[model samples]
Target: MFDVEFVVDIINKSGSSVEVKLDDQAKKFSQIGLDSLDMFNVFIELQDATGKEFSDDIVENLVSISTIVEFLNS
Candidate 1:
């Protein structure tokens, strides 16, 4: 099962909130305050927690918590 709490914990560790606004949600990776390194760490944490490997394309497409939840569920 997808651990939503684990995802949230990773995100929070980056000093960002899950309650992002809709407009902010549509922003690109660079504008979202999460650098490439942050993403790499998140991916590592996710893989460790979920035992699932996420590709670069999939990581790029994950815009929101709900989307992540769906990804994990799928």
Candidate 2:
């Protein structure tokens, strides 16, 4: 299950120690020190984990941890 905690763990383990909670819906990725390249890697990892391919539009709108989880759920 690719939930917020899972995502946060992945992000933190990936070298950025970003702390995220369930209510961080309005927070942007950059505010947590997540750069473009870092996000790109996370996107790839998420795809592999979920076995789902996200389109360019979905990737573009993934501005926050909430958005990422929403997209995964969608």
Candidate 3:
């Protein structure tokens, strides 16, 4: 299951918040306040937590927390 709390915790640990709902808007990497380094960190954390590798294409196209949840769930 894709728990929101788990995701939020990761975001918080990355020194950010998932409080903003990206559900309505198209979420881009830059829009989420994740720079290239942050993006790498996030990917690393996600992989560590879920044992799933997020591809560069997905990283570039991410648009929301929901999208991330979907990716992790997959």
Candidate 4:
């Protein structure tokens, strides 16, 4: 259980909404039609939305939506 809903909204706003699932977390962002910049944008939006700061390490682990939720909830 994590901030999946918030992350989904971010993903949607980032550009595309591809119906992310826990299983998608193990795959790369491109696998779901997003690029690295889009992911970075999502993180930036997240930072703005939650007032939380994220490190570069978060990007490394953000290969999938599950990982994004994990990092957001963290």
Q: What would the per-residue lDDT of candidate 1 be over residues 1-74, giving only the tens digit for each residue?
A: 65556566666565442333434434554566667776676667778777888997898777655567679899
Candidate 4 least-lDDT 10 residues: 15-24
* Tens digits of lDDT, candidate 4, 10-73: 7777655455554565677888778766777787887888777878865776777777777667
User: Is 2 or 4 the stronger prediction by lDDT?
Assistant: 2
Best by TM-score: 2
lDDT of 2 by residue, 1-74 (tens): 46888766656556554555556656898876678888877777777777889788878998988887788787
Candidate topping lDDT: 2
Worst 10 residues of 1 by lDDT: 17-26
Worst 10 residues of 2 by lDDT: 13-22
Whole-model Cα lDDT of every candidate shown, in order: 0.65, 0.74, 0.65, 0.71
Off by over 4 Å in 3: 15-29
Check candidate 4 and list the clashing pairs.
none
TM per candidate comes to 0.61, 0.76, 0.66, 0.71
* Candidate 3 per-residue C-alpha lDDT over 1-74 given as tens digits, one digit per residue, 9 for 90 to 100: 97656766676576443333424234665676656776677678877888886787877765556678877776
Ranking by lDDT: 2, 4, 3, 1
RMSD of 1: 4.4
Better by lDDT, candidate 3 or 2: 2
* Model 4 stretches with alpha carbons more than 4 Å out: 16-26
Error of 4 at 47 (Å): 0.7
TM-score (C-alpha, index-matched) for candidate 4 = 0.71
